[model samples]
Target: MVDRDRDKAAESRRILERISREADTGGASLVSRATKRARNHVSATDADQDDWIEQWGTRIGRVLGLAICVGLLVWLVMFLLRGA
Candidate 1:
């Protein structure tokens, strides 16, 4: 009974290992590749690097986006309160 349990465990491990090996060889899917491309496009460079222009541009863009969103929220609240 103990040997049978051990054999079953070993077989399970072998099957999982083979599955992992095959998945690694299969490569990334289309959605993953597209997501990776989009991520790369959004960021100018890695955090460790020193690319001042791109970094500052990204910061400014984020600030502008926040300001626009806030303005829209204020307008929405005013519109709702006024009941027009």
Candidate 2:
């Protein structure tokens, strides 16, 4: 009876381990695929004529971001000079 119980427990443990490994692999694969797809979409160079609006929008957004960074830097410099 003891031997039977030990064998059953061992089998259950093995099954659980296999399931855990499979779940880990599946989850990782899903995330990897999603990331790769997003990267590809972002890096794709093929542009449609209708994408002009999007292109302009991206450029404007980048310029705004740069302006914000420059403004922050200027503010920091002014603050430092005032403190000094």
Candidate 3:
């Protein structure tokens, strides 16, 4: 019985090792393919695109900030008016 148990454990270990190696290989292949696709999608003039994206991001941020401030002011005024 002890020998049988030891054999079973050894078999399990071997199977687990095989699975680990397969997963590692598959993950590496997936990562390589994804990296290649990403590199191909990006162009040489990405700097120009990045600048425009940054400008738009700043504008959107400012607008959202102003909106939040206005909303808070309106809420405060309404609360004060309700108590008055």
Candidate 4:
């Protein structure tokens, strides 16, 4: 019974060692694959982001300016009407 227990323990250790080695190799492969994919991907650059922000900012500024002009005109008309 003691020998059987020892044999079982040895077998468990061998299995664990093989599993650990396999896991390590698998993890390394995963990292390498991810790195390769990142290198190949053409993602957004800083210039692209800056251009996008500037484009939106210009558009928003124009809209806001138009709104302000319209609002001022409305207010001026109301004031004149009230005074009259």
RMSD of 1: 12.0
| Greater-TM-score candidate between 2 and 3 | 2
The clash count for each model shown is 0, 0, 0, 0
Candidate 3, residue 79: the lDDT equals 93
Question: Which candidate number would show the highest lDDT if scored against the true structure?
Answer: 1
lDDT of 3 by residue, 6-44 (tens): 999999999999998867755467779887755443432
Model 1: per-residue lDDT, tens digit, 60-81? 6766776799999999999999
TM-score of each: 0.44, 0.41, 0.40, 0.39
Order of the predicted models by lDDT, top scorer first: 1, 2, 3, 4
Estimate candidate 2's alpha-carbon lDDT, on a 0 to 1 scale. Answer: 0.74
Specify the highest-TM-score model's number: 1
Which tens-of-lDDT digit does each residue in 1-84 have in candidate 2? 999999999999999999988677554677798888655444432335469877666656666776799999999999999987
Q: Candidate 2 versus the native: TM-score?
A: 0.41
- Per-residue lDDT of model 4, residues 1-84, tens digit only: 999999999999999999988677544677798877544332323224658876566556666776799999999999999997
Which stretches of model 2 miss by more than 4 angstroms? 1-50
lDDT of each: 0.77, 0.74, 0.72, 0.71
TM-score of 3: 0.40
36: Cα error in model 3, Å:
47
